[model samples]
Target: MVVKIIVSTDKRAVKEENGDFGFILWEILIVVFLMGIILTLATPHFGSATNQVWIRIDSANRARIEGAVQLYRIDVGVYPLSVTDLVRAPNGMSEWAGPYLDEIPINPFDNAQVYQIGTMGQVK
Candidate 1:
């Protein structure tokens, strides 16, 4: 089989040079840089939100523990002598509340440590 094809280009086409491929790469680089800047601006806001959520969770746990202790005191007429006292069984005249809390609440900062127990009274 034989085939023939003809191609033609005008003088104007020869004078016109296409734009550089680098222009497209530069546009892409510009878009990436803008995204980086936007993310950098938003990072602190994300951190603040995370801290606020953690603090709210800590405060909620503290309030729950305090309420439970108050109930125990109302029933027994005194705050448990110490943190350990809340976990053990209660006996006579001691006027106790068994397991003041369903379970010991953990310190948010350090889950291994139990939340601190303080004296039952108002602050002056």
Candidate 2:
């Protein structure tokens, strides 16, 4: 068996069949209003999620710096004078096997300073 489909090219007939063929002003306004409401509800959640992400990043960076300091102490037999020592060899250390880190990571919470190393090779 074979089936055939009939198509209409008449503008009036198509418009009448589809009943206006476009959104009215009230329909467009309703869509815009719904979108605004959705955005209003979602904005606060986005801000909180961003803050959570920053907190996690800060924790990971501190841990990484602390590990590097420990490695430096193991290799050179002394804790670094500062975080910068991880990226540069300190004076009079023949066994200084670093730039352990390519560079010290900046503290996200405080853009003005990088993470600090304490006396006992911990991140401060």
Candidate 3:
């Protein structure tokens, strides 16, 4: 499909001899350069935004894990021996009301690690 735009040349645009009008090369280049500069300025802010999102997700995951642990404890009369118990039934265990959690929450910052079990049952 072909669409034609008719414009007379102002300062920013150039026309062919046939008088088709749009941005000149330098004007387009300037826009692209300005966009590049804006992107460079905004890149750090975008990175921090991503970190903030991950932090929120991490905190929510930690809370979900903590809640699951609590429910597991209430049901089984003890804290889980490990986070894996949250996702899989422990061997030969009865009164195991779970797979309480779908999966163990991994540390968001370091994917290889599970959230650390810090002092006082805190997920670090």
The candidate that wins on lDDT is: 2
- In candidate 3 the C-alpha lDDT for residue 42 amounts to 90
Q: 1-124, model 3: which lDDT tens digit per residue?
A: 9886657655434445446857669888999999999999999999999899989989999888788888877888877767787889898779799888887777778899776554345566
lDDT value for candidate 3? Answer: 0.79
Residue 120 C-alpha lDDT in model 3? 48
Which candidate model has the greater lDDT, 1 or 3?
3
Question: 1-124, model 2: which lDDT tens digit per residue?
Answer: 9774438786656676668776568879999999999999999999999899889989999898889988988998888888888998877779999988997787777889777788887787
TM-score for all predictions? Answer: 0.66, 0.68, 0.65
lDDT of 2: 0.85
Model 2, runs deviating above 4 Å:
1-35
Clashes (backbone N, CA, C under 3 Å), per candidate, total 0, 0, 0
The alpha-carbon lDDT assigned to residue 79 of candidate 2 equals 88
Ranking by TM-score: 2, 1, 3
Report how far off residue 45 is in candidate 3 (Å): 1.4
Candidate 1 lDDT (Cα, whole model)?
0.66
Q: What tens-digit string does per-residue lDDT give for candidate 1 at 1-124?
A: 9764334464334344343223356778999999999999999999999888878877887787777678677877877655555666555536665676667656656678666667872110
Q: For residue 38, give model 3's deviation from the true position in Å.
A: 2.4
Minimum summed lDDT over a 10-residue window in model 2 is located at 4-13
